[model samples]
Target: MNFSGKIEYWEQSTNGTWSLFAVNPSDNFSVYNFCGKFGSCNLNDNKLPCKCLPGFMPHVPQKWYSGDFSDGCTKNLMSCGDTFLNLKMMNIGRKPEQSHQVGNETECKELCLKNCDCSYTYDEKSCLIWTQELVNLQEEYVEGYNLSIRVAISDIEPTVQNCEPCGTNMIPYPLSTSSNCGDPMYFSFNCNTTSGQVSFKALGGTYRVASIYQNTSKFFIQVMDVGSLRLNQSLPFNLTTPRNSSSNVSSRVTDDVEIVWEPPLEPLCNLPADCKD
Candidate 1:
């Protein structure tokens, strides 16, 4: 079925019956899904499918509420430092004006920050940076790359000093043993020694501190099984399981699981900071 502003394309299903492919200009499909610049489209939101990106507000609130987002959004506030907010599983439908082959994501971020024209940066196998206004951005539930959006420094909170050790595990500076030690939301750690094994109090199971990456604000943890992975509160970090060197379960079961936690791209402290945390 086709209409003046919408199209319903059909496709053959695996069972050999014609099925509805998609409906353009509806919730699922559109040529300009997000409506305008700096707008993000989400099909899950029925009433308001389009939303302004972080640090941004609707350019015209009345137009936006009336289901007309042609004007898009503008920045709400400005801050001191250069920061980028991560938008996961988003489809930004445009090629970046410039691209670079960097060593890693960290390097890619640094390069983007140095260039004032760069507005967005993406990292997969290579790094791609965009200088133009972002348009037609759509969110997907699964299978997408992370797009880091640049913002100001005043928006970010500073980190606190909270480096302490529980047993043999040394909790890093940003990670504290108590509530008063580190940044309350971003850098808090709990240590439990009741079981004679050192473990993160927030994380239920016992784990051994393997290594800490201060520059990246990340840490490696060794545990017996992957099932024990749990965090007491939500923080701006990505937890991933690293590959085990040994395949023998009996020989290396206790040391099989390795968890790597990565902080956000933005620094929790001011520039020229030390690696103590």
Candidate 2:
């Protein structure tokens, strides 16, 4: 069958009727169906289908804006420091260049840091490290593993504490349950206990806080009916897409998305005396 400007494969039904099977670009099975190397594809994002991972910029900006991600992305800042940003629920469709058996996550982190060539690392049952340029790293909305990418230390903001508790979820300093609790620049969360189950609004939508990273100021949240949630791009938080596309599924399932809010990078005036030029 011909669809738009592309040809698609079709199958004949029992009644001898032809039905569309797959088409290039639109079909999920096609090569480069998702994003290209280092470019993440979000089907929900009608305006921007592909985006570069944090701390990286499109290698060929002109081509990327024209919907060509074959060149992928390049690191915005080249110098690697002690800090690494954790991008959770990522589908990296390749094997690590090196694998190690580490006792704990801390050891896994240290191993990756010591190697200047290491660009990514993962710790589950064991530690896996990648010493080459990361590619085909897709952000998954459903199930996936965390990929820590080496970043410059200047990019990270120090963690702070303020509020106490909203059920089991701890309200960190920058994020508060009350106006008096957190920074006014950031919004407040409303904790509802009417159902005897604690739940709060991360920004505009309701979610159950799964985990909080104090150092990174990131939250792992589980939201129901994610399809209905319209994400606001102006907000500081970042949302992950479902790992596997459920476009054809009739029923919806609960999934977790990582929400991270980082305060703007500190100004040059805020830098320490010795660190300044």
In the range 69-183, model 2's lDDT, one tens digit per residue, is 7787766677766767666556666788878787788888888888764656555648888877666555444565567777664433223325434322345556766665455
lDDT of 1 by residue, 119-223 (tens): 555556488888777877776535545677676533322333534334223355456567655555544345544311233433566455444445556665555
Clashing pairs in 2: 140-241, 141-241, 141-242, 141-243, 142-242, 142-243, 162-173
Model 2 lDDT, residue 14, Cα:
98
Candidate with best TM-score = 2
C-alpha RMSD of each candidate structure in angstroms: 14.4, 10.0
**Candidate 2 lDDT (Cα, whole model)?**
0.57
